[model samples]
Target: MDTLSALISHAEPKANLFFSGNLCGSSSSTDHPAGGILHLVRTGEMLLFEEYGLTHRITEPTLIIYPKGKAHRLQPQTLDGCDVVCANLTFKDSPLYRALPDAIVLPLNELDNLSDTINMLFIEAFTSRFAQVAIISTLLDLLLLLVLRHLVENRICQEGVLSALSDHKLSKAIEIIHKQIDYPWSIDELANKVGMSRARFAALFNQTIGQPPLSYVTEARLLLAKKLLLKGEPIKSVSLEVGYSGSVAFSRAFQRQFGITPRAWYLKQH
Candidate 1:
């Protein structure tokens, strides 16, 4: 994959990873929730199926990303009890996840070694505040690393220009955009960072990501602006925080992105 697409997965100003697990359930259980699910069965097995046929049989380290909030099960072959470690997770609403499929399973790859990092999420969710949120926060980082490795190692879908975001150069640009959300950026700079010419970067980035480099930069910045605004920053401050030369430019961009003016958005907050 290209750089930018790869970079998007790691892009932060991301959602808090609120759950992880060391759960082992041998009994069949059904779940229907807005939250998504991921499962890894080490010993026995798991069957993930809907009303009719089978969706998946988990005998290995199976990774499922359920987006439709559909009903599914986790258990052994007989539709009865089985051993499984499952994770129920949710993320703060963000634009990036909009690109993922409702569900996909990938090989565990090399990420299994980092299982402890993932296990900590379960600890954080169920445990008291004895340690610190920092531990859970770090777990999220590592969890992201695993998901990223899985997505990269085994990409199921083969559609959409956005999938090209998995490309290396483009992913690099995305990472830069995310890491430096507060800095004003130019396509030329992003292009250079990814070792491409301005025109080349624009065309390739646009083709793969379904948006031009400028739009992406603006989108990334405005997303950050909204986050800052949500944190109670003033309009002018939010504008500057996201790299606008002035609040007016930022306002226009923000309106273009979210369908309302910054002042209106801020007022709604108060």
Candidate 2:
């Protein structure tokens, strides 16, 4: 059988599911599509963690997600039977999922634990025999949001500057920087704002996030600048808002990251 299998019971004119089926394998070979995986533990438990790496498990009465596309193991944790419902989803051109980090996990021991709306999606798909693609698509969106929310609430991120923002001191510091991208934020001052000694705060943040605090803020500001520029906002406006003195600095940063000038990107994007 293929790595992925989907069947919609209903075929409505306005499709409700993009694709639905089972995704299982003897092993997590590279054969699976490079996308997200949503899995529900139907019976026995599954231990899904990696050694000295990023991983989480799906015990009974649990819901687990593989957002970063990480390779992990799954099998019956008990003898009852390891039944699972798995979905391999891809949100091509969806900005929301694109903005998310690699992986997120949520726990659900009961079917009712999931959003009622989301559960209804499967119910309709399984019960109906028409085009349910529309419903499934929307349900998948909610699923993606919940997955990201899991990461956000837990503050576990495999990608994005949010990794740095996960720090309490740095999160606060980053908040201030975001609020005042126009203001020059010093690491010493930010540390003081968060009630940590400059040396201690900097060290802790660097150790936790693998980058200098100031660099983190700079990159975040540049990202904000890019967002604004993408919206066709004036370069000067973006620079001033993101803490740059003017368009020159912001444009330079944008160019450095995209290998294209902000204006060029804006024109092409628009």
Candidate 3:
């Protein structure tokens, strides 16, 4: 699988449509902890207020992405208000969430590839059609994917996993890591696969991804183990599935990373 595909295959984002209409007044994100918040402005103008006293006056059609759990607000610039379709986006345990900026503002016209999808979404959101809600929900999910693609292709992220995926050589290594996470991968082998010397590849990966390759592998394995364990898989099976030699080693690593034992973590969740 390709880098972006592998990345998404491991963690696909979900969107829950919460509001769709003209905003004559203001709206604040009271939902304290969401993976992200998305807004597509179909018409008119509005002012975006973000944390740290940042503000942006948005005109024309635009896409706003708040990719972290940061507070934000929106108010109309005119009495006519702005027509918008908004959703709460959730990317549970996704590395992309940490790589994304506090907020992203992109003019709709700039995203030519999304024009058709955006139009269809606006029509469905405003019309009273059969399964309108369902259709809109699906469209929002698609939009989120497209936005991620845009970010990667455009090199919107300067650092972190997303940025690393944008690099041709690093992306190859990342794809292999995600696709065969259960394999016993070594740094030298990863570098050879990507045609880079061990030192160069290690340095580049660390520079771009902000972590050593092996450290990233451990993180990915543990995250997958966490998911499997949550599904009621036995600890032994989960450990082996994520490339651990035994449950004891996996438990030690899990506790070191999460500050609790695997059983204790799962029990707390239950």
Scored by lDDT, the top model is 3
What TM-score would you give candidate 3 relative to the actual structure?
A: 0.95
Better of 2 and 3 by lDDT: 3
TM-score of each: 0.66, 0.58, 0.95
Regarding lDDT, does 1 or 2 come out ahead? 1
Clash count in backbone of candidate 1 = 22
Quantify all predictions' global Cα lDDT against the true fold.
Answer: 0.61, 0.56, 0.87
Looking at candidate 2, what is the lDDT of residue 205?
75
| For every candidate, C-alpha RMSD to the true structure in Å | 5.5, 9.8, 1.5
Distance (Å) between predicted and true CA of 146, model 2?
Answer: 2.9
Candidate 1: tens digits of C-alpha lDDT, residues 1-270? 444343443334222443343434432324333466555444446667765758777666555655434466654654334433344555433445555567666545545665676455655655678655676666655665557555545554343333654577876777677677677678778888999999998988777667787777777677667667777878888777778888899899889898999879878878
Candidate 3 displacement at residue 187 in angstroms: 0.8
| TM-score ranking, best first | 3, 1, 2
Ranking by lDDT: 3, 1, 2
Q: How many angstroms is residue 23 displaced in model 2 relative to the true structure, after the best TM-score fit? A: 6.8
